[model samples]
Target chain A: MTQSPSAAMESLSVALGERTYPIHIGAGLLDDPGCLLPYLAGRQVMIVTNATVAPHYLDRLRHTLSGADLEVCEVILPDGEATKTLASVERIWDALLAAGFNRRCTLVALGGGVIGDMAGYAAASYQRGVAFIQVPTTLLAQVDSSVGGKTGVNHPRGKNMIGAFWQPRAVLIDTQTLATLPERELSAGLAEVIKYGLIWDAAFLDWLEREMPALRALDAAAIRHAIRRSCEIKAEIVAEDETEQGVRALLNLGHTFGHAIEAHQGYGNWLHGEAVGAGMAMAAALSAERGWLTGAEVERIGAVLAAAGLPRVAPAAMGVDDFLERMRLDKKNLDSRLRLILLEALGRAAIHDDTDPAMLERLIERFPRA
Target chain B: MTQSPSAAMESLSVALGERTYPIHIGAGLLDDPGCLLPYLAGRQVMIVTNATVAPHYLDRLRHTLSGADLEVCEVILPDGEATKTLASVERIWDALLAAGFNRRCTLVALGGGVIGDMAGYAAASYQRGVAFIQVPTTLLAQVDSSVGGKTGVNHPRGKNMIGAFWQPRAVLIDTQTLATLPERELSAGLAEVIKYGLIWDAAFLDWLEREMPALRALDAAAIRHAIRRSCEIKAEIVAEDETEQGVRALLNLGHTFGHAIEAHQGYGNWLHGEAVGAGMAMAAALSAERGWLTGAEVERIGAVLAAAGLPRVAPAAMGVDDFLERMRLDKKNLDSRLRLILLEALGRAAIHDDTDPAMLERLIERFPRA
Candidate 1:
């Protein structure tokens, strides 16, 4: 059942002027060295993955790369959100130097969001910048984080508090990788898939509603459509605002609350997608209260997250004060004032700087605890 | 004497399209709060300096900052090129997070080149990028590194081996700070001043040939002219090639050879410009052998370096083999072939990719041993 690499593959370009690159989406991209070779800066390629991911696909990837006349180096890191740190990036830097990698070398990020972030940041800072390709193996990465150039690692105080906005040479997304993903990881990734529908495309949201069961079942066509639409929405936003100066903030609709959730629970306790799912529910509820969305619309949002097996409520341990404390540390906050992206409608989102503190507190208090 | 901030100051802009910034060169700029306040992203400013620099200028800089409605945070680092490592950058990251600095916060680099490089890198990566101001205190910084967007730290493998092209919001160059600089440091700064003449302007070179005594005497008008001209040449080149893609590399005339000398002697042993001074001599010799410049022209280059108190010879300890080994690690090399910026004639330079190893070895062998 070996699928040809070029068979029915789709390519979407991220038009970022000189840094523009293509997103190649297909079922068997990993088997095709040509897909990765063309984007490399030189004959030397460094693959950065994690311990968890390496045991599953590293050898296969290595075997594929062996066909090309390129020098390949591998740096496998400990896996998890908790492992994302400056120390981790330093290790990669050390490895690159030890391997004699120069500016001409390219780094291939071969795992989920954490690996992509660390590898991308490594490329951004190594020798003051080098070329890197994203071979995102997780659904969450395929749909959102890997598409946009927002690469970074988390801090003790906040998530993704340290990093750079370095775009990749290309992103290779193989839907077949989803077959090996853990059930929770699959559901967590769906949170972001659902988010694209919630924030930018209402009609896409309607499609998600009808195809919820099929998406959960990992139906080929349904999942591919979900990932493609999500990437299209993300690519469009990222193209316009590469540095998150303006419209790019719309992409963080649930991320403000979600980052707080992940930080409070401690990174890796609740997957990023799960926290984002519940966070989006909170955002929807707040938008409804602000008269931007209907109460029924809020309920619909929660119902989808529930069907997607994502949490629609906050952890019982996290009280209103805890959420406030964590959210204040968000990068979006200015002068200690919380700024968040709120939905004006299901398909429309905007940055809100005037969120009332008292109202926000009450809103956090009212979220279904635990 | 309390000098009026606007009494007599020079401002030059480094045009980098949208990321263009101004380099304000003058005396007593540390006493001027208005020049710094306008470029700050927010009221919070983190001043990153080194121990050697702090004792001389920190309080004065802090006092001026206090005049504005700003929250000032200071992180004093150990002084020396050896302190420029990822570990130092990590410590700064910790202090920043503990201080609750957000994306809106600005990092003000208030020391020499090492300080500017590290602090600028911190700004580039912190919270996925934040605004930074470069308040370069050394002659080398005010004229060269501070004006360019090259920000980085040294790896155990090479100098400036890890960094980014993070542009500053503005660069504040206070010539008054140079009064406190050491004699050796002043001479080291002259190397870069001489570099402007060697790579771009023959008239400037002739001027240096005549005014070398006045320039070394630290005559105010002469020194200011040297600094301004150096920055002007750097700004023009940087504007044309912001990322070192083409002609901008001419600025690294002596850097490739110089970096090898610095790394071989251990960083901070030979000041950056001293290494560049000797490195420039090596490049001059090589160009002469290639029939691009006369051997007499080579002697003139060496005489100017000698007059400026810069080393006109490489370390006798480093053999041709050692130089070749270290030079191979340079970022400019492609496909393991050494690509050097060599002089086609005095004040005119070009990138030389067709250098023969045997001829290069002979050139290195011919260099007078120290």
Candidate 2:
């Protein structure tokens, strides 16, 4: 399932006025210096990656950034969602300081979502921010995390409790890196692809249902199209609302429920995409409960998630109170009200902070469990 | 002398377009709820102060915020420049989460620069940017740190290595708080006050020279005028360059040399203003070395610092290389060049990055030592 080396690259910009940046999607972009060299803030570059991703892409990136007057260094951290802490970010800062890297230095995030997030935060706070470029290897990162400027680490009580809204100079998504992605992780990535369709485009949702098999089979064309379209929708939304002030919260259709699962199970046990998969289903069911979505539409969503090999049921051990408590700590909530993203219909979503507590409890109580 | 309780409150605005905020200077502002209540983003408020200042003003602040429907909480950190670390900021974040404070909550920083910096960073990162107000008690904070949007903690390698440019909703300067400040600390704060005069206004510098005794004696009118003028100059510069891209670097006239002294002596020992005082003298001497100022002008600068009871020499133990190594890591530097802000005359300062390394070494080697 190797992508053709000659596949043309697609470039799109996340328009944020003065902070606008490009998202470059192609096969073998990591091996091409042209994709990375222009975005380097200066001659100094620090590549931040993790153990799980280093053996595969670190050397390739180093080779691409080699030659010339560049002072390139690296900080290899431990892998997994559990390892996404401020301590790990500190390691990146330590390495940067040890190398005497200046504010002009550029940080290249060379792994999946965890690496991208930590590296982005390191860039955000390092000497009050330096330029950074994202080289996402995971499908989930390419389609979601890497595109948005949301960068931070998980706090013990709540996820992403400490972070800043720092955007990158560019996002270089080399689709070829997905060759080594695990099956579960690939399915996890599809959960977000399905999400964009559920929230923004019903037509794209139809395209996804027809193309899920090809997407799962690692068909290069299907994968590239999925990544590109996902990025486009995200860029459009981010352009409209760069800081999640209004329309952007619609992007978190399943995140409240998903974060609950992740926190309850400890971070690494349930993959973010897996939790998102089940969470989206729960959101769909709730939408149906509110009469905004039809029962058949909810069933359609569940089937597509199943086709993508994502969980469509909540973790059996999680009780209604477990979900409620974790969701209460969500960043989206204002004051006392529980703000949620609910679908009005396929491809359209809205924020609902007035959901009846008893009805929400009933929905969670009767929700199917795995 | 006690400031008249009926002294009229003077307010000015830091014009940053949509992010513009007001700065109020008066007597007994901490006890005035009308000053603090309007700036709160929501009903939730967290008061962040240090142990030393808490006993003096915490209860007064709590009382000011108590009567409303506000859910007010507080996190009192240990006092000292040494306590300005990420760990302390984490404690603030932890307190906010434990209290169930949401995105719309506001944080009120009530102490010196260290407390304001940590609390501001906490507000900046909590839920990815919450509202915060600055209630600076120390003279140095009132004149300098609280007015600027710069907030962060010091890393072992460098001061303010991790931070963000986060502005506050308002800055409340209670002139009466200075009544309880230690003489040594008051002198330390005057170092920054002298700085405002030296860097931007020669007439102000002359006025400071004449009024140093009144300022040191805590003349109610003299102290109030100095704080207001210093803040006015700082706010004008900050509004012109919020992120330190251009004119803002002039504000660091003596900071490069000062930071080296602080790092060598350890943070709390030298005090930031003391270091800056000596650093300003060093900058004046170097300006003479570069023919930008006459020897008489340089001597005048040193004499003024001494009049304010601030040091005019680097630490005796620090060698030439010790100064160079620490100053090289200063945030103002661009790439490999050591960017220094040096006096051009009695009041004007400019950044010079092409200073001869040998000349800088000789300046440090021959500079007076305490």
Report the lDDT tens digits of candidate 2 across residue range A1-370: 7664435899999999999999999988988888889888888999999998999999999998886579999999999998899999999999998888888999999998999999999998888889999999999999999998999999999998888899999999999899999999999999999999999999999999999999999899999999999999999999999888899899898999999999999998999999999999999999999999888999999999999999999999999999999999999998878999999999999999989999999999999999
What tens digits encode model 2's per-residue C-alpha lDDT throughout B1-370? 7664435798899999989999999988888888989999999999999999999999999998888899999999999999999999999999999998999999999999999999999998887789999999999899999988999999999999998889999999999999989888898899888888888999999999999999999998999999999999999999999999888999998899999999999999999999999998999999999998998888888888999999998899999989999988888887878999988777888888999999999999999898
Top TM-score: which candidate number?
Answer: 2
Score residue A254 of candidate 1 by CA lDDT: 88
* Correct interface contacts retained, every candidate: 0.83, 0.67
CA-RMSD of model 1: 1.7
lDDT of 1 by residue, A1-370 (tens): 9667878688898989999999998888888887878998998889999998898889888888898788999999999999998889988998998988888899999999999999999999999899999999999999988988889898787899989999999999988889899989999999998888888999999999999999889898998888889889999999999998888888888899999899999999999999999999999988987889998899999999999999999999998878988898888888887898999998888889888888888999988987
Error of 2 at A367 (Å): 0.8
True contacts kept of 2: 0.67
**Which pairs of residues collide in model 2?**
none
